[model samples]
Structure formats: C-alpha cells, structure tokens
Target: MNTVEWSDALLLDYEPMDTVHREFVDLLAAAQNASDAALPQTWAAVVAHTVRHFGHEDEWMQRTGFASADNHIMQHRVVLNLLREGLAMAQAGQMDPVREMAGELAAWFAKHTQTLDAALALHMRREPPPVATVHRPRGGRGAHASPG
Candidate 1:
C-alpha cells in the first residue's frame, strides 16, 4: 500500500509537470517498501528523484511566473534537504532515520497537495489545459490513494 499517492487534485494540469509529480508519489511508495538494510539506497534514489521533481516544478513556475513560486520552492528546498540529511544519517548506520522521515514526508505531502499544490493546480487550469502528455487522478477526493 502507498503511504502517499498522487492525484489530479495535486496537479496544476500542466501535463509535463504533473508527470513528474506522479513519479514522486510512486518513488515515495517504493522508498517506504524498501527493507531496513536496503533503505539508504532507496532513500538516495528518492532524494535524487525529489530534487528532479522540484526542479521541474521550479522550471514551470519560472516559465509561467507563478506568484507563489518562491514560497513553494522554498518549502521544497527545506523539506528535500531534510530528507537528504536523514538519508545521510541512515547511510551512516543511524538505522531509523528514514522511517521517522517517512512520516514527516507524508504529512508534508498531504498539506502541500491540499493547499499549496492545489493553488498551483487551479492556476494552471485557468487557461486551456496544456498540451503535454500528462495523467491526472480521476474521480473524487479519495480516487487516489493517500498515506496509510
């Protein structure tokens, strides 16, 4: 089961960008399922993907001049750096760092999706939906999975 799942509600309707966001949720689930001994490796992958994901969003924000881009990017930097730090500690044999970090990440994910990301999604939809190939979650609020 996924600890956090991506959905249309979290998207800005920017296909290219939404694809990256969905990948982030998928990666988050993969990291959560990794075993203790394999977690650091999984976390590193997660961290790399997260950086890429944030970068993509930043790029979109820059191109579109989203007013909240600065604030959103700042939040991304803070949370991602924290995840990277936790990964470092876990790699150094701290053992439980990613587990605690998972919970934190999940909380952050939910809040961001419901509030900040939601705003961006709404903004992106103001014009005709973008032409990039993107998939958004279908149906209602619970149509997509969330943290367990």
Candidate 2:
C-alpha cells in the first residue's frame, strides 16, 4: 500500500495546491515501493518535486500575506533539509534512512496538509487578486506549474 493515499479528505479545494500535493503523495509512494536499484533516483525525484512544491507554497503565502508565512516556510526548509540528508544517505547505500523518512513524511504530510496548507488555501480564497502577475519559476521535476 502507498504510504500516503489521496482522498477527498486531503482536498484543500485549491486546485493548484491540491494538484501539487497529490503529486507529492504519488512520488512518496514511488519512493517507498522502488526497487533497491531504483530507490536513489526515486528519492531524488521526490526531493526535486518538494523543492518546487515548497517554493510554490512559499510564494503563495508571500503573495497572499499568510499570517504564519515565516513559520510555514521554516517548516518547509527544515523538512527539505531532512529529505536532502536522507537522499545523501541513500546515495551512500543507506536505504533504511530513506525508507524511514518516507514513512515519517507520510504522517507529517497528513497533518501539515490539513492544518497549514488548508489555512493557506482558505487565505488564498479570501485574498484579492494581485495587481500584477506573480512570476513563478517553472514547475519542479515531474509537475506542471500554475499561477499563484
């Protein structure tokens, strides 16, 4: 079974964020199920996706003036750092850490999505559109980008 399963419960009703989150769950599952030889590449894919995923959310938070922007971004940074460390360990043939990290990420994602991400989604829905177009970087690795 996938470490994180997608369902209605995870929907934030924000298409852009929901799409990226679904991709994150899928990537996590891929990493979890990867063959030993494929684990590093799969994990690297997840890291790349997360970099863009978090970057996209951070941009949205900044644009929308999310009340907890700093705290949210900091959480992203910390998690990304740990994921990178797991990737490095996987590169060194230490797959156990990567597997464990994937499991932990599943739990973290559930709570973070329902709490932090849901709040951001609600905030975005209530914010007025920006006067100018927000310039988002091209989407990360396997995902497509949408305007924030």
Candidate 3:
C-alpha cells in the first residue's frame, strides 16, 4: 500500500492505458512494501515496468499527435533516469534513496496521471488511432517496437 492508490481519480477511461497504469501502481506498491533483502529486486521490477509503461504512453502520444508530446516524453525520460539512478544506488547497498524516490514518484504520478495522461486519454477518445500502429520501439533498453 504505497502513497499512490489505484483509485478512480487515476483512471483514464482508456482500456489499454488504464490497464498499464494499474500494473504500474501494483508494481510500485510491491516495491514500497518489499523487505530490505527484496527491496533492490522489487525496485528493479518497478523500473522495468515503468520503462515499458512510459514507452506505451509515449507511443500513444506520438501516434495520436499529442500536442505536448515533447514535454510529456521529456518528463518520462527524466523520471526514468531518476528511477534508474535509484536502482544503481540500491544495488550499491544504498536503499534509502530508492525509498525516498518511491515516495516522490507516488506524488509525481498522481499529478502526472491526472493532468498529462488525462489529456492524452481525452484526445485519443476524440481521435482514436489504429491499434496496429502503436507498438513499442526497438533497440536499446526499454526500446519500443516500430510503429506499424
């Protein structure tokens, strides 16, 4: 049970996106509740899920001509970078920072979902894109498959 719960306020009314978001919340909570011995691994899981989660959203934004694609993707990059940094610190036997980052992410996610993601959901509803064109990119870590 992390600070960020999967409440209706977080739902975007878009099935695929909402499903991914719910998974993100679950993974995050798993990390937050893991024991000291499990923290690093749990945190890593969170990072991995987030990488994919953000990638999905980023792809959707790109496909839907989201007006704030640049800003939104930049935020994703920064957050992913920070999460990776936390993972590194955790691997080096420094868990406090990762814990703190989890809390910060809880706060940040609440706002991000409510605002940026909400707007994207609204746009998508108005102008739905073909599902086939939204694959994740390839190459490198968290790479998305090419858009079809």
Candidate 4:
C-alpha cells in the first residue's frame, strides 16, 4: 500500500488547493514505492511541488489577511524545511531516512490539511475579495482615476 492516498478527507473544496494536494499525495506515494534507483528523483519531485504548494498558500494568506496566517505559515515553513532536509538526505545515499519521512509526511499532511488548510479554504470562501471598485468617467465624458 502507498504511504498516502487521496480521499474525500483530503479534499478541501478549494479546487486549486485540492488539485495541488492530489498531486502531493500522488508524488508522495510514488516516492514511498520507488525503488532505490528512483527514490531520489521521486522525493525531489515532492520537494519541488511542496515549495510551490506552500508558497502559493502563503501568498494567498497574506493577500487575504487570513486570521491564522502567521501560525499556518509557520507550520508550512517548518514542514517544508524538513522536506528539503529529507531531499538532501535522499541525495546522500541515505534512503531509509527519507522513506521514513515519507510516512511521517503523510500523517502531517492529513492533519495539516484538515485543520489549517480547511480553515484557510473556509476563510477564502467566506471572505470577500479585495476591493477594486470600478470607476466611471465623470459625467461620462472625462478620464477616471481608480483608487490604488
């Protein structure tokens, strides 16, 4: 069996994030099942995707002023750092460490998605987007300047 499998519990109802999460699960499973020769590359792919994954979420949190942004971002940073370390370990011919980490990562991902990401997705769905009111020309005959 794979270390991680995609299920409804993993779905956040945020399509963008759900899609990324699916990719993460698949890549992690691939890493977990990879042979010695393919392990490093599989792990590397997971690391690369996670960098982008966390980055996009962090950016969204910042942009939307998510209430728990700081703590959520901290968790992402710490986890991503550990993942990067695992990638290095994989590259160094130490396969067992990263293999173990893959399992740990799956557990972490489950909780992280259920709590932090779910909250973020709910916040995103509930919160109104940033204000960018369209401006009409004065009297319909002059230039309009939009607020920054």
TM-score of each: 0.74, 0.85, 0.85, 0.85
lDDT score of residue 97 within candidate 1: 62
Report the lDDT tens digits of candidate 2 across residue range 1-148: 2287888989999888999999999999899999878999999999999999999999989877789999999999999999999999989999987898899999999999999999999998888766976565565343555568
Model 1 misplacement above 4 A: 6-13, 127-148
Flag clash pairs in model 4: none
Per model, state how many residue pairs clash: 3, 0, 6, 0
Q: 2 or 4, which is superior by TM-score? A: 2
For candidate 1, write residues 1-148 as lDDT tens digits.
2277666666666566577778877877777877888888888888999888888777777778899999999998998889889888879878576777876787688788778877777777674545786555676455567778
| Candidate 2, residue 18: lDDT | 94
List RMSD in Å for every model shown: 13.6, 9.3, 8.6, 5.1
The CA lDDT of each predicted structure is 0.78, 0.91, 0.87, 0.91
User: Which is superior by TM-score, 1 or 2?
Assistant: 2
**Candidate 3 C-alpha error for residue 118, in Å:** 0.3
lDDT of 4 by residue, 60-141 (tens): 9999889999999999999999999999999999999898899999999999999999999988878776688767777775
lDDT of 2: 0.91
* Candidate 3 backbone collisions, by pair: 136-144, 136-145, 137-143, 137-144, 137-145, 138-144
Task: Count clashing pairs, candidate 1.
Answer: 3
Question: Which residue segments of model 2 deviate by more than 4 Å?
Answer: 131-148
Off by over 4 Å in 4: 129-148
